[model samples]
Structure formats: C-alpha cells, structure tokens
Target: MRNFLIDSLGLAGFGAMNYGLYLKFGLADALISAGGLLLLLALAGARAAKRRNESKGAA
Candidate 1:
C-alpha cells in the first residue's frame, strides 16, 4: 500500500541518517539524532491520525 511504502522510506531514511551521523560523529550523536527524529515522526503521525479521525467523524 502507499502508506506502507511511505513508512518504509521513512525508516530507510532514518537508518541512513543515523549511520551517516555515527560515521561522521559517533554513537552519542547518532543516538541523539535518532531520538529527535523519532519524536518528530511520532508527532507527525499523531497529527495525521487526528486529522483522519476528524474527517471520518465529519462524514
């Protein structure tokens, strides 16, 4: 599904970014970056879910 693909891409991007950070900086930097990214992703997903639920309720 489209959502699956998007989620897959997001995970892939996260992995790549984390690896790059680890290589350039270190494990600590990578961990921090991953945590921040996870927080952002969680917020975005929550917002999307809220919008979806509201639209369903309206209909």
Candidate 2:
C-alpha cells in the first residue's frame, strides 16, 4: 500500500505539479490550488497512518 502511494499517487502529483508550473505560469491562483492539493494529501496520509497504528493496538 505504501509503495502504491509513493509510486503511483506521489509520481502523479509531482508530474501534475511540473506540468502545472509550465501551463499555469504567473498565476497566483494556481499556486494556491497546488497548496490546497498538497494540504489534502498530508491530511489523508496522517489519517491513514493513524488507522494503521490504531489497528496495531487492537491486534
């Protein structure tokens, strides 16, 4: 699962960001949107890690 996240989602995200920088040049809104996406990803990763730890204690 971790490998999937790093190999697929992470690669796609950086790929998009790289393309976004070229396509959406000089636009502050684009940067804001990128930041928002990164924030959401961070929140999701935290939630997943939390669940993993929670399940470990239950086991």
Candidate 3:
C-alpha cells in the first residue's frame, strides 16, 4: 500500500539521520538530532490532524 511505503521510507529516513548523526558527531549531537526529529514528528502529526479535521468537516 502507498501508506506502508510512505511509513517505511519515513522510518528509513529517521534511522539514517540518527545513524549519521551518532556516527559523525557522537552522543551530544545525536541528542540534538533527536530533539529535531521530535519536533518534525510533532509538526507532522499536527498537520495530519488538521487535514483529518478539515476533511471531516467538509464531509
């Protein structure tokens, strides 16, 4: 399914980001990267929620 592929790609991207950050910089930088990842997830969740609400209201 399209959603499965999207989710898989997102997971891969997160894994790559974490791996690269830790490998290149170490723990401290990796923590920063984690915060950034959390922020990104929060923003994405908010966007998804908004779209769902909009769609529900339109229907």
Candidate 4:
C-alpha cells in the first residue's frame, strides 16, 4: 500500500519531468526537480524497507 504509493509518486515525478523536458524546460531546472523527487522517493523507500525489516524480525 504505502510502498505502492511511493512507487507511484516516483513514477509520476519522472513522467512530469519528462513532460517538462519535452516542453523545452531548461536542462538545469528539470534535473533539479527530478533530483528532488528522486531524493524524496529514495527516503520514503528506505523508511518503508526499514519498517518491513523490523516487522519481519519481530515475527
């Protein structure tokens, strides 16, 4: 569920950035936005993975 949301967000972000590039947005701007989203996605994924591992260890 949460993992799905995180993945979706990441996908959506990429799609948006691609669209921006297609629309001729400056390279630096597009990369910055994409990089920010990637960082956010990475953090969320790491957190979710950590929680899953903890649950498995408890069980």
Candidate 5:
C-alpha cells in the first residue's frame, strides 16, 4: 500500500544518509542521497494527495 512505500522509502533514505555520515562520506554525497529521499517522499505525498482529491470529487 501507499503507507508501506512511504515508510520503507523514508527509512531507507534516512539510513543511507546516516550510513554515509558514519563512513565519513563527504557532504556532497550525503546531500545527494538526502535529496533522492526527499524526492521520493515528495512523490509519495503527492500521490496520496491526488488520491484524496479524487475520492472527495467522487463523493
């Protein structure tokens, strides 16, 4: 479901950032991972919002 995707993607993104930091990866690399995660989260939110709008329109 949508919830599962959001949760898993968010956690994976955070984990990637943390792992990068722990391994002494540079800021640029960390930022890249973080940006990717942000994009995923944004897309998920948009999908949920669109579904909500459609449901309301149907009612």
Candidate 6:
C-alpha cells in the first residue's frame, strides 16, 4: 500500500511537470511543484510507517 501511494504520487508529479512544460511554464514554478510533490510523498511514507508500527505494537 505504501509503495502504491508513492508510485501514484510519482506518476501524478510527472504528469504535472509534463503539463507545466507543455504550457511553457517557468522553470521556478516547475521546480517548486516538484518539491511540493516530493514533500507530500515523504509525508505519506511517514504516515504509512507510523500506522504499520502502531499495528505491530497492538499485535
């Protein structure tokens, strides 16, 4: 599930970058968006890890 979430985020990010490129957006805008997506992916991974740990502790 965690891997799936990360993969989905990556795909979305790529699509977003492509769209920005297609629209001829500025480099700074694309870089900022990429950074935002990376942050989101890291957060999602951390959340998933926390949940997994909780379940292990409960078990």
Give the top-scoring candidate (lDDT). 1
| Global lDDT scores for all candidate models | 0.95, 0.81, 0.93, 0.83, 0.84, 0.84
Q: Output the number of the TM-score-best candidate.
A: 1
Stretches of candidate 3 off by over 4 Å are none
Error of 3 at 10 (Å): 1.4
Local lDDT at 14 for model 5: 87
Give one digit per residue, the lDDT tens place, for model 6 in 1-51: 999999899798798776776478777777777788779989998999999
Report the error of model 2 at residue 52, Å. Answer: 0.3
- The local distance difference test score of model 1 is 0.95
Backbone Cα, N, C clashes tallied per candidate: 0, 0, 0, 0, 0, 0
TM-score for each model = 0.84, 0.65, 0.73, 0.65, 0.62, 0.65
Clashing pairs in 6: none
Which pairs, if any, clash in model 4?
Answer: none
Give the per-residue lDDT digits (tens) of candidate 1, residues 1-59: 99999989988988998999999999999999899988998899899999999999999
Candidate 6 lDDT at 34 equals: 73
Model 6 quality (TM-score): 0.65
- Pairs with backbone N, CA or C atoms under 3 Å apart (clashes), candidate 5: none
What is the total number of backbone clashes in candidate 5?
Answer: 0
Task: Give the Cα-based TM-score of candidate 1 against the true structure.
Answer: 0.84
